[model samples]
Target: MARIIGGLTTSHVPSIGKAIAQKEQESPYWKPFFDAFKPAHEWLAREKPDVAVVIYNDHGLNNFLDKMPTFAIGAAAEYHNADEGWGIPVLKPFRGHPKLSWHIIESLVADEFDITMCQEVLVDHAFTLPMALMYPGNIDWPVATVPVMLNSVQHPLPTARRCYKLGQAIGRAIDSFPEDIKVVLLGTGGLSHQLDGKRAGFINKPFDLWCMDKMRNDPEALARLSNHEIVEKAGSQGVELMTWIAMRAAMTGRVKELHATYHVPISNTGGAVMLFENNPQPHAIAAE
Candidate 1:
C-alpha cells in the first residue's frame, strides 16, 4: 500500500526564491534561510519518496480572483513554472503523477469534499519557492508531484477545521491506494507576516513560534483553532498556516519534529521551515 512517510511545513516568501536564484545562499543575508533546509534536503535525498503532495496557495498567477476554487488538485502529466508577471526566472517543468492525482480527486469527491480538477495549471512562486528550498542545486526534482492548491488569497477561504478534515480524508485515500509508493505531504507558506496595506512589514515572532510549538506537540488543539483567531493572532498573511495544519492532520499518530528553522524579516515575512515524521503507532487521545 502507498504510505505517507512524512510531512513538511515552510514559509513561502517570494524573496526566498530571489535569494536562491541569485546564488546567495552562502552569503550572510541568505545563509540562515538556506542553511536551515540543508538537513531537510539531505533527508529527502535519503528517503526518496515517489510523490509529493504539496499543499499551497496561489498568488494571482494561474488563479486570479475571477474563478478561484477553494481547493484544486492538478492531474496534469506535467506542470509549467509560469512567470508570475514579475519575471522571476522559471524552473523546468515539474513532472506530475496523474494517476495518483486522479485517485485523490475521486476519493475526495466521494468523501464530499468538492475539489477543482486541473489538467493544466501554471504554478506560481507559492509552489516553486518551497521546491527550490527543499531541493536546491537540482536540475530536475527527483520525485513526481501532485499539487494540492488551497485558497489563501481569496476570502471565504476554507477554515482551519475543514482543512484538517480534508487532510484526514487524503490520508485515508493514500492508504487505500494499492501502489507501493512512498508519499510526502508538504504544507507551504507562513509563520506570520503581512504584505499589504499599512501593516505591510508586520512580523510576529512570538505568535509564530507559539503556533509552531503547538503544531509540533498537540496538533489536535491546533485543529480547533479558527481562521479568524489565527489571523487575529498571527497577522493576516498567517492564514496561510492552514496548509500546515492540513499537512499535520493528514498523518496518523504523533509526529516527531526532525528539524526546524526560523528567521525574521525575509522581505516582510517571518520565514520558517519544519520537517516531521509520523509515528507508526496511533495516539490514544481524542482529536479535539
Candidate 2:
C-alpha cells in the first residue's frame, strides 16, 4: 500500500519568490531563512518521495472571495504557475498524479467531506514557492504533485479541528491506495503575520513558537483553538497555520521532528521551515 514518508512546512510569502528570482537568498536579510531549508533539502534527497500532497491557501489566484470552496484538490495531469501580480516570475508546470488525485477525491467524498474537484487548476505562489524551496532550481519538478488547497482567505473558513480532521481523512485515503508509492505532505503558509487593517504588519513570536511546539508535541491542543482565537493570537492572516495543522494530521504514523527554523519579518511575516519523518505504522488518531 502507499505510505506517507514525511511532511514539510514553510512560509510561502510572495517576496520569498522574488528573493529567489533576484538570487538574494544569501543576502543579509534573507540568509537565515534560506539557510533553514538546507536540512530539508538533505532530507528530501535521502527520502525522495514519489508524490507530494501540498496543502496551501489560494490568494485570489484560482479561487476568489466571491466563490471559494472550503476545500479543493487538483486532479489534473499538470498544474501551472501564473503571474499573480507579485512580480514573481512564472514557473513551468509541475507534473500531477491524476490517478492519485482522483483516488483522494473519491475517498474524501466517501468519508463525508465536501470537496471541490479541479481537473485544471492554476497554482499560485503558496503552492509554487514551497515546491521551489524544497527542490531549488529544478524548473522541471522531480515528483508528481497533488495540490490540496484550503479556504483561509474567506470567512466561515474551516475551523482548526475541521482542517485537522480533513487531514486525517486524507491520510486514511492515501493509506488505502493500492499503489506502492511514497508520499510527502507539504503544508505551506504562516508562522504569524497580519497584513491590512489597523494591526497590519503584526507578528507574535511567542505565539508562533508555541504553535510550532504544539505541532510536534501536542497538536490536539492546537486543533482545539477556535478561528477567532487563532486570528486574535496569530493575527488575521495567521490563520494560515491551519495548513500546517492539516499536514501534521496526515502523518498518521510515528512522527519525528528532523529539523525546524523560524525567522521573522520576511515580507512582514514570520517565516518558518520544518521537516518531519513519518514512519509507517497502524493508523491512529489522537483523542479529542
Candidate 3:
C-alpha cells in the first residue's frame, strides 16, 4: 500500500520566482528567505520520495473566472508551466502519475467529494514556485506528481471543515492503493498580505505566527476558523491557507513539525515554509 511519508507547506509568491531567476538568493533582501528552504531541499534529496501529492490553488493561469471548479485533480501524464501574463521562462514539463491520480479520483468520488479530473493542465506560479524552492537547480523534478487544485481565489471557497474532510478522503485513497509507493504531500500558498485596494501591502506577522503554532500543535483547532476571520487577519489572499489545512489533515495522527521559517514583505506577502512528518501511528479518529 502507498504510504505518506510527510507533508510540506510554503508560500507561492511570484516574486520568489523572480528572485530565483535573478540569482538574488544571497542578496540581503532575499537571503533569509532563500536560506530557510535549505533544510527542506536536503530532506527531499535524502528521502527521494517516488510521488508528491501537491495541493495548490490556480492563480488565473489555466482556469479563468468564467468557470472554476472548487476542487480539480490532474490525471495527466505530464503538465507544462504557464506564462501567467508575465512571460516567465517556462520550465520543462512535469511528469504526472496517471495511474495513481485515477485511483485517487475514483476514491474521492466514491467518498462523495465530486472532484473534477483534468487530463492536461498548464501550471502557474502557485505550482512551479514551490517546486523550484523545494528542488532548486533541477531541470526535471525528481518525482512524479499528482496536482490537486483548490479554489482559494473565488468566494464561497470550500470551508475549512470541508477541506479537512476532503484531505482525509485523499489520505485514505493513497493508503488503499496497492502499489508500494512513498508519497510526500505539499500545500502551497499563504502567510499574509493583501494584494489589492488601499490595503494592498498588508502584513500580519502575529496572526501568521499564531497560525503556524496552532497548526503544529492542534490542527483540529483550525477547523473552526471562519473565512471572514481568515481574510481579516491573514489578508484577502490568506484564504490560500486552506491548502495547508488539507495537507495537515492528510497526515496520520498529529504531525511533527520538522522545520519552519517565516519572512515578511516578500513581494508584499508574508512568506513561510513549514515541513512536517506524519506520525506512523493511526489517530483515534481514523478508527471511527
Candidate 4:
C-alpha cells in the first residue's frame, strides 16, 4: 500500500512568481518570506517521493468557462506551460505520471468519486510557480506529478465540504495503489488578501495566523470556514482554501507540521509556506 509521506501548503499568486522569475523576490518585505522556503525545498529533495499530487486552481487557462469541473485531474503523459497572455520566457515543460494518474482516476471513479479526467491541459502559474519556487534549478523533476485542479477562481465553486470529501477520496485511492510509493499532497493558493474591487490589496494578519493554526491543529474547524466568511474577514477574492481542504482531508485527521512561514510582501495579499507529514497510524512506523 502507498503511504502519505508529506505535504506542502503554499500560495500560487502569479505576481509572486513573476517577481521571482524577474529576479525581484528579494525586496525588504519579500526577502524574509522567500528565505523561509529553504527548509521546505530541502525537505522535498530529501524525501523525494514517487509522486507529488498537487492540488491547485486553474485561472481559466486549461479548463475554460465552457466546461469547468469543480475537480479535475491530469492523467496526461506530460504538461506544458502555455503563455497565458504573459510569457514565462524561460520555463520548460512540466513532468507528469500517466500510468499512476490513470490508476488514481480509475480507482477514484470505481469508489464513486466523480472526477474530470483531462488529456490536454496547459498549467498556469498556479502549478508552475510553486514548483519553480520549491525546485528552482530543476531541469527534470526527480519524481512524477498528479495535477488536481479545483474551480476556486471561478464563481459557484465547490464548497469546503465538497473539497474535503474529495481529499478523503484521493487518500482512499492512493491507498489502493498496488506499488509501494510515497505521495505528497500539495495545496497551492492564498492565505488572506483581496485582489478585486476598491478593497483590493487588503491584508489581514490575524486571519492568516488563525488559518495556519487551524491548518495544523484543528482542520475540521478550518474546513467549516466558508468562502464568503474568508473574503469578508480576510480579503475579497483570495479565499482559495477549499483546495487545501482536499489536501488536508487526504491526511484523514492526522498531520504533523514540519515548517510554517507567512508573509505579505505585495500589498493587498498574504503568502505562506508550510510543510506537513501524514502518519495515519502512529504504530505503522515500526512496521516500515
The candidate that achieves the highest lDDT relative to the unseen native structure: 2
lDDT of 1 by residue, 42-95 (tens): 788889999999999888888888898999999999998887777678878899
Give the candidates in order of TM-score, highest first.
Answer: 2, 3, 1, 4
Write candidate 2's Cα lDDT for 159-236 as tens digits.
999999999999999988889899999999998989979999999999999999988898888789999999999999
Q: TM-scores of the models, in the given order?
A: 0.95, 0.97, 0.95, 0.92
| Candidate with the larger TM-score of 1 and 4 | 1
Candidate 4 per-residue C-alpha lDDT over 140-167 given as tens digits, one digit per residue, 9 for 90 to 100: 7766788999887667777777788888
Model 3, 115-215: lDDT tens digits are 98999888888898888888888567888999999998889999888898888899889978889889999999898889888888889999899889977
**Residue 106, candidate 4: how far off, in angstroms?**
2.2
Give the Cα error of residue 179 in candidate 1, in Å.
Answer: 0.3
Q: For model 3, what is the alpha-carbon lDDT of residue 258?
A: 90
Task: Tell me how far candidate 4 lies from the true structure as C-alpha RMSD in angstroms.
Answer: 2.1
Error of 3 at 93 (Å): 0.7
- Root-mean-square deviation of every model: 3.1, 2.9, 2.3, 2.1
Q: Which of the numbered candidates is closest to the native, going by highest TM-score?
A: 2
**lDDT (Cα, 0-100) at 45 in candidate 1:** 85
lDDT of 1: 0.85
Say what the RMSD of model 2 is: 2.9
